[model samples]
Target: MCHIMHIFLNIKFFTLVDFCNAISYEHVKLLSILKLHNVKFFQFFTRFYQYHQGGGFVCVTTARVCSLLQYLFIVLFSTFLVECVDYPVLFNNKNTTADGIPITGKRHIQLMTLIFVLGIDDDNLGNLTWCEVLALLCQKLPDLHVIITKDKLNELDICQRILRFKNYFVALVNKDMLPPVVNIPFLGPQPYLSSGLKLNLDFLFFWGSFSPWEGPYTLKDEYKDPQNIGKLSNSFVCINTQCHKFFIYTINSCIPSVIHFFLLCGAYKKRSNTKLRHFNELDHQLQIRLSRSYDFATRYMNLFTSPLIEIIAKSLKFVTGSIFAVLFALAAWDEDVLTVNLEHALTLMTATFLIVIVCSSMITSDDCVYMPERLMRSIIACIHYAPISWEGKAHTRAVRKEFDSLYPLTFRYILEELFSPLITPFILFFWVRPRMQKFVEFFIRFTVSIEGLGDVCSFAQMDIAKHGDEKCIFILAIDGVAFDKDEDYIANDGKTEISLLNFAAMNPLWEPPPLAAEFINDLKTHVSCLSVFLILFEHILKNVW
Candidate 1:
């Protein structure tokens, strides 16, 4: 029936003809991609569901489970193959590198650059205004400054506002030959100058507005949530050394964001949209930088973070070589290798299954993020890409309903499987540990230290970041230093003279986990109960059943 349904859908799709009956080619492509991914997901989840449903005991013939798993790998590999074929078009090789344009120095980077907008239709508020952004940069960049490098600059209020800054310098670029994009082929965009900030900048940041291009739309910024990754590229930055780091990671994360942005924005005519243009670009750029810190958030910080980390960590197990090994070893013959592997299977399976669970949690997001890159990559393949969004409203509704329908059964099944191993630990940790800790302050206090400190720092940073320093300090005054450290802690050495770290550590906010020695009493009770139940069940199933 499932096979027949699949065939029927395929036939109907190809047969459709007429205006209303027709779907957008993009939408059609999305369905095709979704269909493939959905199949992979279904096969994986079905086996996973069944594995946990039957009391979490595999007890199935090893050969049978092994076969399903092999088939599962093939389906998943096909998805990867589809992606490998599709990701190149939307993104070019290498991330944006801070390469040569001859404006870098060691302690001082003196750049005289222009943000030439390629074009903006006169009707749109955001078509090409750099007023708020220029004002904000001139104000915030400490000792650094910018000058009006072009005569055209004097013509706009945004540029005039910038000229008023304490350290502003001015120059006028020739309007006729303005480089519209940040990077041009023959001669790069106007170079920027950062005297003392060259060494410390996350990356010497700047952009070229699409003022001159007169192309399709305004090009504001081409990045989102970019991160400084690996080694610095060419970032030498001595007056003559002239090093510049390309920041590949940042550029990669931005591609999808930029493409999506262009798609949403590109479709509109300049005259149709009128919106206030304010201090948006700079704030957005800073936000992107901050989110890169998500790479460091611990599991305790966010439950979701652990799952993503686990997915990235386990990517090796699903490698082509690994898949080949499984295929190569499939004879199931009675050789020393088979026996040895079988003996080790239990341990490996436990680890593999746990990893798989973590990866599965990110499947939805992973699917969303890569779908466009994949589809865009396959531009010539004619395979339509899925809508690249975390929230596809219509799709979300369907997923929610589907998830809800499966939730009760899945949750119950998972709970049953999970409860077996966890029940003893839960009782020990929650019930037993508390009783022992009731008498021991030192042990109890030590167990949750990071969380305590994390709560303080995270909450404080979040507040300070949202409101200004004054607002943060004002709010801080009321929270009142609970401990002496609060008074002395330094937030960041680079940001300000004030220290928040002293306050961070001295607060005695976080406590470390307890050693097992302390929890033995509670553990004994749970372990005993669990052991007895297992033994009894074992005999009942083995002998009675």
Candidate 2:
């Protein structure tokens, strides 16, 4: 028996090492100790049982049984294979130096030379990469400030510089060209520059407008439009236009009113169609108010029909079912080998049946619990955003009814129709673990953090600042409709000390106004919605699977 145990341990250890080499060293060590103790205990128990048996036939039978058990253990251990799981690669070799040295003075000189050469070509100025732009800003621009700004500098120069170079800088960064070389120790290849560079630039270049001036504008003909100037592109350049004095003005402030123009255009164009005409002239303000009201109602509905609770309940049901399955297998095997009183056996079978019934009921109930809430939310979203009309309303109603009818049977249908045959294989091959969950959560959060329009805007602004101040000169490039009849002259408050360029007009649906209270509230709502969505997705993945 001891020899058999030693052979089994050797086979188990070798198999485990081959199959699960990626598992931590500590875990492998612990498994070895556990296997040794378990083998010793089994050997001792078998020997004691055989000695207590007085008959030679019984002793022989016990020895055969022990041998059979050892063979079974060897087969089971051989079949238990775990795939190696690799750790995620977070850093790359390209961004770090082998010797862990900082950027040397000689390398800095090389970068500066590259920037100067790139800046000499008017046509290629916008084509400079992110490394060239940073070098230009850090090394050359400070000394050439007078040349770029023409000695008419003031506090407004900062604003103008940002406006001019924002587009070019954004282009470079977008291509992942910034921080030309990373020489950090232990933590590289190169990661992106700090988020502050993008954020501060976005705030600086928030407002800009077109102005007619006389001088050489370096930008391409296609980029002359004001709308195209601030967008992400490598071809943006500042024009050296002549104006009487430095001033900024808001050319078109009430841009959100264009929504009315679109609505009216649709209404007039489709007036002959009764269904389309009904939605064409709907009040925008009324829709917004109703949407807000619906948002409030859905908050409470979500609380009552929380998807997380439903998912947890379903997970619990799965766990209970698995336990019952194992117990049933064990009970059947025991009944074949061991004698038991009829009354005790009956009681055990009855308890197992009751547990199975309860688990099935719980799973069924949990499966459909959140379906009503989802249907309601979907309907609300459709109505809130869609054009208001009888046709649209009818479509939404049809969707709602369809969802209601399918909710109760959906999970069962999916399981039986899609997963019935795969269930055993899935249980054998797949497992849920905390580390995998953490990796998924980290990835989601990283994605959500970078989704904002402001971040892109910021990167664009910084790109512009890196080129030079000459790119800040005013140019006439009007694209949008004029705000009023008085668009000919610059609307200034005659305050030269303060620039009007600092003010940005509010667009209700696009960029929110910078009013403190409204901005804060909107930010809070956006963050809350993002957090809820992440939680819901995580729960669904965990419980549904």
Candidate 3:
């Protein structure tokens, strides 16, 4: 009967006639892309219900759980593939020298010059051929260190090779081998920066926010004594090369002497270079202490410094006082209401427990911030400043629901999830099921089939002609690419181009299509010439100005 029902539904929904029944091709396409269908629709609602309650340890049937775990394992294994796991093997090449070859200073300088002239940035390091990379790595420049051994390099796939190069680049930076204006790129977008969230670091120190350190402190005389050596275990002693040899103070110390030392060292200022230098110079004990202190200060200092902190404290006190007052009122009643109606006492207790849960959730939901004000402020900020790129009532509602669903699996979260089943069905029917047509249309419109790959999203296919933007034409032209504007479509932000390059870079042996090969050549040529042009431009500007 189940098999019959499935076959009937497949015939009804998956037929060409059923697809043509939609209002228009465009409408159908939009709907298919946006809405869920078949098994995916069921999965969406299942996840919706799970998240709606508060995400927990997701449990599934034995049959389905294996499939779910299989996907999860794939994700984890993909990350592992990027890591350096292979043993190093020596490369035997007459064209490329072995690692750690003794070379003259002139040859070393030549190698450095070659690298600098190449203008290869970390992001595009993968674009180079394996031979080119291997040649550079094999040279074993005295300054630029390589962590992956020759054996590992010989066996590594493209992804691992790129990762190894990035690691090498980082090592160069750490050793101050790279010249000025060269810096490591932050791989992904930063939440605080992108979201426009302000962390008032200046106000923290500038507003006379200092409090007298209540922690243990030792005088210079006491620290000098051999008798008081054991007492120094609880203390942090930092040496100031500019001033005294060492000063003993605990974490959170704001004593005048410590403050004076901080000012002289310029440690109070938000300078990464200065801080890094000072941090490195510190003794092991002081280094550990400073690290802990900095972390603690950055995370929780706002809680203490904010004027609104007092309000939260007072509000909690007021709620506790009110609860006690209610209990007192019941105790002082002339009539024995509690005895007459014992259920009332039980109801009151239950209500209080719920209130406590709600308050605890507010406190602990966001990384144990324990600040209701902060949570409220964050929500308000999000509402006001969230990107409206996907503007629409439906989109907004969906986004808001998604944001609200994110919570740690605490007692309150568990309770919410437990009760979610009661309302999930109603929500699915009224809110989700009505939009089934949209999901169907969306999938129908955006999905494409490639030989051997079966079905995939059109976007994943990277069809430059369909989705490409014309605005990128000049940018491509600037890179020395000679292409017919009428024939070739320049991908928006060169995403398709970059994606292809990345794929080719990762799979060194994989031969690209003729068009793809031409595109890659153009891109590489552009990159090489662009770097030289930039250098010349910089030089000209410097001389002219």
lDDT of 3 at 203: 17
| Candidate 3 or 1, higher lDDT | 3
Task: Give each model's clash number.
Answer: 59, 11, 20
Off by over 4 Å in 2: 1-145, 154-156, 163-217, 222-545
Q: State each model's CA lDDT, in order.
A: 0.27, 0.29, 0.33
Q: Indicate the TM-score of model 1.
A: 0.16
Tens digit per residue, CA lDDT, model 1, 251-337: 422332333243333321121100111111122322333233222221111222345556665574465335435533652444454
Q: Which stretches of candidate 3 lie over 4 Å from their true place?
A: 1-420, 470-474, 478-545
Number of clashes found in candidate 3: 20
- Sorted by TM-score (best first), the order is 3, 2, 1
Pick by TM-score: which candidate is best? 3
Candidate 1 ranges beyond 4 A from true positions: 1-284, 297-324, 328-545
Q: Against the hidden true structure, what lDDT does model 3 obtain? A: 0.33
Best by lDDT: 3
